[model samples]
Target chain A: MKDQNGFDELARQKLAERDFTFDPSHWTAMEGLLARPGRKRGAWWPWLAAGVLLVGGATIWITAREHDPAASVTNPGGGPRAIAGEVKGVNGSAAITEMENASYGNDHPGTMNADPAVPVTGETRATAGTMRGETSGEPRMRTEATRTRKEHGTGTSDRGTVTMQVNKIPVSSISVRQGEDPHAANVRTGEATNDVSSTMTGPGAAAVAGDGASDERSNLATGAVDPVRSDASAAPAGGGTHGEEQPDSVLQHQPPSAGTGPVVVAGSGDSASTGATAAPAPVDPVAAALVPPAWLAITAPYELTLLGGAFSTTGRYTGVDAESWPARTERQWTTDFGLEAVRNFGRHFAVGTGVHFSSYKERLITDEVSRTEQQLSTSYFWVAHDTMVTIVVGDTAINGATYHMTQLVPMTINELGVDTDTAYQTMVIRQRRSALNTVSYVELPLLLDAHTARGRWVFGLRGGPSVGLLTGRSGSLPDNSGEGYHTLNEVAFRELTVGWTARAYVRYRLSAGWSVGVEPTMRGQLFNSLRNADLDRRASAMGMMLSLSYRIQPTPQP
Target chain B: MINDHIIAGCVRQEPKAQYELYRALYPMMMAICTRYERDRQEAAATMNQGFLKILDNIGTRRKEVPVEPWARRIMINTVIDAHRRNKERKAMEGADIDDHAEGTSGINDYLKDMEAEAFAELLHRVPAMSRTVFNLYAIDGFSHAEIAGMLGLSEGTTKWHVSHARTVLRNAIAAEAMARTEKTVSR
Candidate 1:
């Protein structure tokens, strides 16, 4: 037997080669997929899409109701109040909701900036399996509150409403006119608060917290003057519209706890009423409009993959020809099949799992090799999810199909007058061997996706290790006595095996509905003993793949 | 089908920018499995299978990532996954099993001097099982706890599997220790 290299040293070397260059391949199938328009469906991806649709849809619905008269009159939180008929006076139920909405729009102060990095693991590779520590709290990503203004410029010549500015735009009432830049109106209204020092930040907070706080904060925020004009039918009604007035009154209110902080509400005008005849003032603090956002709401995407795999050991591997170590090699093919499913928790993040099965065989590429072949031997992989990190941990076959070694010299082609360089004459020495094995394990991969084009294209770099346990293998290296062949190691191979892999791929989304991708990968064995007593000696194989995919959103439309 | 957004992993080696990288390329990676794999399920499994190597060694295989000929390496492997299948066939043929005392330390310890990249290369030398353990405990941040939970192994057994990594790596390192040490700088 010949000597081999140190397994640990090899592993280190293998890992250090993270600098592999990239190569782009044409993925016909995937490219075609990206080019051909299609719809997207998914497992968990659907849920993510659905979640966005629900919230986004609700937001849109609110926006559509912005110009409705009934909505405006019914709203108790916005600043515009309607003049109802009957006994209603100059001051109907003061809109408390409007007062609160007004305070929320211009009073509170906050800022947006970059947050700190949250480290999830340690620096060294040895202690890779150590438990992770907790990270610090982070700030909210963003906070925005819009204020709408309707200017009656020189449109029909019959309108006198020169300009009306309504602060604090609800999700439902953004705008219908195309290509109009709204002005940012900031009002200095935090002066009335003397005893409102609790958590509320506004002039009117003092009126509610300490003394008799009426429902007037919403009016201050909305800035909607009373004598309301009807424009519900003239709204940017999708596709077809003619009416310039709404049947329902519009209502707007600042949702409690809008962003990531505490939300405070007082006993202000939470109730607002809009009717035909009533003592209407220049400004009502009770009623306002609601409007939802549009396509800008689509901030993230859902991802899915249909995958297939084939693994063959028709290459140099552990102890397959143990007798000569590296010099004598035996080719083995382990046909394995796998299926995996993945779901993204958010835009560049996800988790998944899979199932694996394989069949093993030992074949001598040269006369110097002859070993056992395992069939339909079972094994499976458990993983956190799918990633490009290329960690392939899970169960594996060991001596389950060990290729014991028997030294044998090659048959020289020169004996037959054939030149060594001639394809007609090939010389090779092989070894005879046999073994058995079965293994199962799990893989965890953390991926790094470098994003560009506002998340349209991405090149991914992922790496994480995997863990596994060797369950069992052929109890003994079985002899081919029935075939009159001697067994090299009549005993099973090692119970446990370990190694690592490094790989990468690049992907591009051609449009909103399609994407194409490709990746060339290489896997090298870092350790051994899973096959022969072979040490340090490793094997490697490289491959390329091309694929395509599409994007799909939920029904509600985010 | 190359979209404008994806950059091959080979071009990106910085440790600080990995999370975003994995996300952008995962979908197309899933589609890649259809070729060599029997079906989408197997392809997906193989993609996850590649994780053992990817998570553990992508930082080192930077060369392979870029030089890949139109083939993006999305952590999905083919040959290594084949090892178990080969073994399975032999098992059906009645190969023997040997339960012996696993040797410890000696050359295995000396080989430790080699860098992490070297070890990652050597991992590709053996069956899939060995690589899985070495990566799980040595590179991918999986704890024996999580590893055991995922692989359905006793924590103790999972630990033993990790220890077994030394033997597999030793055999590979012992063979090309010199060439590895010299070329280590290239990574």
Candidate 2:
């Protein structure tokens, strides 16, 4: 037995010295496990960056489109062409007539400034003039003109040789007066019929009579120009000889309706008769570029929203032996914040995507079996015997048996000692403990919303899937043995979880570009929170959300 | 030996330092795990789990104490935790009986020399409980009382298991010796 023990010692020494071959594969596996927690913590960064880049790219594209000159010109019915017609007239000839009429000396007949040596009959006039008119009561016509110059026909006039270029005129120079009959004013000035004849003979007269009538009417409705004042100003300047000859010649070609109210012409002067002999007034390209395209007024708007809310959170558990642990989870509060960007498709529909952070918290109470080690002392009585011997020395020699004698005696002994044994007792404790579990996640939501506006109020419904990356966890849960609680921080939760969110919101527009809203929301997870766990836990929250939204208006790119 | 810098780096979860520590501790951790586990793959897995715990708690380690022993203690605890988790399944399978029956035979050929590898093979021949108890009490320098507390057994039971493990190893060594002698005589 001794030799065997020695050999056992030898064997133990050898076993202690044992070393298995090192396999790099094991380290590879370990490295992966080590990186897992860190990877999960940083998983949301890429998603966040992607969302920022998407929003940034969208902003750049929208702004780029807003400032692009080519973009404005892409629309055929509006933009620069419309601006030109708005400020000047259909063609240069009409602008010349407006300039010539506007430049007429109002009270001086000889100061008419008609250059007869240059023959205003069949020659182009480069004229820049400004006209300002005000009427008293109802909607009145207002005509704006820049300075007029005869580039090729610079002959001496009574007012001296008038030749100058007017690069730009301020928009403030235009004004509309209310309550004035343009034809009555023209007739009161005694230039009604001749003014009509001059305007009809201009270059764009046919177009003004046809497709350009609405443009002319729109301009008139807005009191952009007043032909009555133009004719009144022109009558004293050249209405005597020039107007009489032009009226007779031009009236021969009048469309019968010319009799009714001076034809409501766009321009009125003798210089306007030669339709092909006028140069368009020079306009500031910068001002023309300021007018937004017609399409932009109806273009979809983008909304950026910052939202926050509190929710009632609940967790539903399922799977293996799930019912055995009947953990009653108390409804708790969940809080969330998000930044969202929505691109409106039109007035009624929008699509949004954003990043959010949410914390889910719950208190769970359940039955657990607790084991404790206790020491117990066990005592018993036992009888112990001791033999006693007695000797008689002197008288033993004479009587052989009487000289010495030995006697035996028995005694009972009792003692106490400490017990080194340990005993474990299992107790079922019911509802005596509760654990608070909290999990935080970074979520990216993609939503589609449909909304309608009524007065200052807007109502909408938004719903979609949100993908979440678990960022952190805390607290505890029942262990698999139901013997105690295990710290949830050590639990392997799923790194990524998908969920669905739906909300209905009512918002009140605070201004042209800002709104505030209240939304009632519900969100629920679609997958288990724990990875490879027997228990399937899905969390859900119902909350009221308050949101502040700003409509991102497309600004002119500087 | 792992230095303080390596330990601090591990606490910071630096991958290079982690790999360095893993390399330094692999031989010791694997030896301990394989003594308790029969399969090499399972032993490696258990070692990794223990290493992870060591890395996680390395910052809390007493600077005065050497790192190897501290890491070994954590590795042992991890093995015990894994044992407790799988205990019910092991009990249901009645694996202890099969292990004992298989441990007693056909192990002499592996005991040609009492080298560490051969000794490890011999140790695996012992029954699971007896082997684990023996490893803890003998090689790991755990007292019978400590082994009893760890395995939830009486001290006497722990002693019995140790004695049983020694007997098994002793018999296998004797068998190998006799086989050697017989071969010599035939030659």
Q: Give the TM-score of candidate 1.
A: 0.25
Task: Encode model 2's per-residue lDDT on A1-558: one tens digit a residue.
Answer: 122325556656667677666799999899878768653232354456446544654554454344332232221111211111112221211121211221011111100111212222212112322222222221222222221211111111111011111111101011111112222111111111111111111111111111111111011111111222323221212222112122433333321221111222222232221111111112234433443323223233799999999999877666663545645567799899999999999556799898889878888776455556676756554445555545333344564555445455454444544445566676665334688888899989898886755445666777799998999988887766655667888777999999988777888778767789998777889999888468888898889999999888778569
Per-residue CA lDDT of model 1 for A1-558, tens digit only, reads: 112344433444445444422212222232333234431221344356435544654443354344332243222222222111000001111111111122222222211111112111111111000001111121000111111211110111011111111122211111111011010111111111100111111111100101101122222121121211221111111110001121222111223212111112111122111111100112232222131122212233554433233333322333333333312223454433333334445433444443323222334322233354433433443334333333334455576864434444333232222222212323332343433322222322233222222233444422233223343322122222222232323434344444333334456667554566664333334455344353223333334445454455555545
Q: Which regions of candidate 1 are displaced past 4 Å?
A: A1-305, A309-336, A357-491, A494-496, A499-526, A529-540, A545-558, B1-187
Against the true structure, what is every candidate's RMSD?
32.5, 20.6
Number of the predicted model whose DockQ against the real structure is largest? 2
Residue-by-residue lDDT tens digits, candidate 2, B48-149: 999989887887889998999999999998987887787764343323333232234334334435577766775677777777788888778888888889
Show model 2 residue runs off by greater than 4 Å: A1-300, A368-426, A429-431, B1-187
